[model samples]
Target: MGTEHRTDEHRTDEHRPDVDRALKADCASCFGLCCVALPFAASADFAINKDAGKPCRNLRTDFRCGIHTGLRDSGFPGCTVYDCFGAGQHVSQTTFGGTDWRRAPDTAQQMFAVFPVVRQLHELLWYLTEALKLRPARSLHSEVRGLLERTERLTGLAPDELEKLDVAAHRRDVNALLLRTSELVRAEARRGGKDRRNRRGADLIGARLRGADLRGADLRGAYLIAADLGGADLRLADLIGADLRDTNLSGADLTGCIFLTQPQLNAAKGDSATRLPPELIRPAHWS
Candidate 1:
């Protein structure tokens, strides 16, 4: 679904406010960490490459992108696609007690380092939370919810603790769970519960798949770099960890696509004719 349809992570009919905040990006309450804590290269997406921890040239003292309204026209189209998953605001308000980098320059280095770590944890939360929402994956709902709670707890760790956290190890663990969940949901996408095509970890870079009926295909971790998916029927497809970089999604229908993150969408090419899952902002680079 688009931008993760928000729902309560209820264990016993209680609304978990903390879990709700873990999924969406609250940019206004953030320190513009994506524009500063992260780096960019001087490509079509950016005017120049910026080093990590260095504030972007277009960043203001107020911690907002100065060229936000005109990012695409201003030669920094990449910025328009970055989503921090609420890690920025949580790092600023909760982790560091609302002390920004400018006001407390001494903490900048450590803050920048921890931003990415928490961001990964939050991204996992987004996936795990969505996994719980799938009716076809009902068998794995308990398992997914458990992982979601643990990932949420990791988001609240102290700065020093978070700095030392092994994020890749945790991501591997979550990936295992999501893989099973994908299989469960995608199985039902086929008529009479037939198995979907399992192209997990296949190298399909630049392969032509235009107008292909790929509904419910298991494309987990598929290397689809630069693959032409124009006009493909991708409804209910499982795209968990699929490398969609440089892939053409122009005029392709992605309605009901599963585990399709914004980062994946940002990496791919698409035009206005592309039918996306609701709430996913179309990339401006796509004409």
Candidate 2:
């Protein structure tokens, strides 16, 4: 999916030296599960309408995207921003013993059903991994570790078990832990600051926040679509689930920002001057 071309440097978080390499997408080792299992609508992001369990029109016989090098130019920009969090490879290899859907038609439906479930679990793994790295959240580290291990075990469940998993409930439990971790980290970050406003779930769509002092701001789940956040100081801000599509991040400092994923950056507008977290790579389309 989105992380197909990521290099070793981009796949890791240096803060967590023992970060799981399998948490990053390895498209070469995958069965192109994202291309076949997920549905997409015709919009600014995708060029055609696709249904779940149907392979994308551009998917090749060998389970690779035909327009891999020119997906954006070919009007499949949506594919470029999709991160399966390494679920594709895990399902293709571990879940199915490296048997692709094409070879074992009988398993195709179950494979597709299990992919999304495992994907959600992997996303939780990513966040929990980062949570353990936050020094300010040290007191909660043991709890985070326990959940991380539990989530990892969930990903390894049989396809049948994975299909029947109550992923939403599991996500709720994990999110509660992450929320506590964010509070601890942000409190440490804003210890001496007065701008401790809690903007959790705020609707800031297209708002002009240029050069704003958002350091340590609680922006969890904020709708920032097309917002002009250029030159803002977002250090240590909690950005989990924030809609960043076309949001201008030019020259903004996002160093140490909590829960910011690569797909979020890929969907936004940024530039050379934007200070990103060490684990994330700058999108190529940024000016």
lDDT top scorer: 2
Per-residue CA lDDT of model 1 for 1-287, tens digit only, reads 22233332211232245565666788888888888999889997789989999999988988888888988789986786677878898899999999998899999999999999998898888888667666777778788888888888899999999999999999989989988877766666676666466787889999899998888898878999999999998877888889988899988888777888887898899887788765366765677
**What is the C-alpha lDDT profile of model 2 across 36-135, one tens digit per residue?**
8999999999999999999998999988899999999999888888999899999999999999999999999999999999999999999999987787
- RMSD (Cα, Å) of candidate 1? 4.0
Per-candidate clashes, comma-separated: 0, 0
TM-score per model over all chains: 0.86, 0.94
Number of the predicted model whose TM-score against the real structure is largest:
2
Q: Which stretches of candidate 1 lie over 4 Å from their true place?
A: 1-21, 190-196, 271-273, 279-287
lDDT of 2: 0.88
lDDT of each: 0.81, 0.88
TM-score: model 1 vs. ground truth: 0.86
Off-target runs (Cα >4 Å) in candidate 2 are 1-19
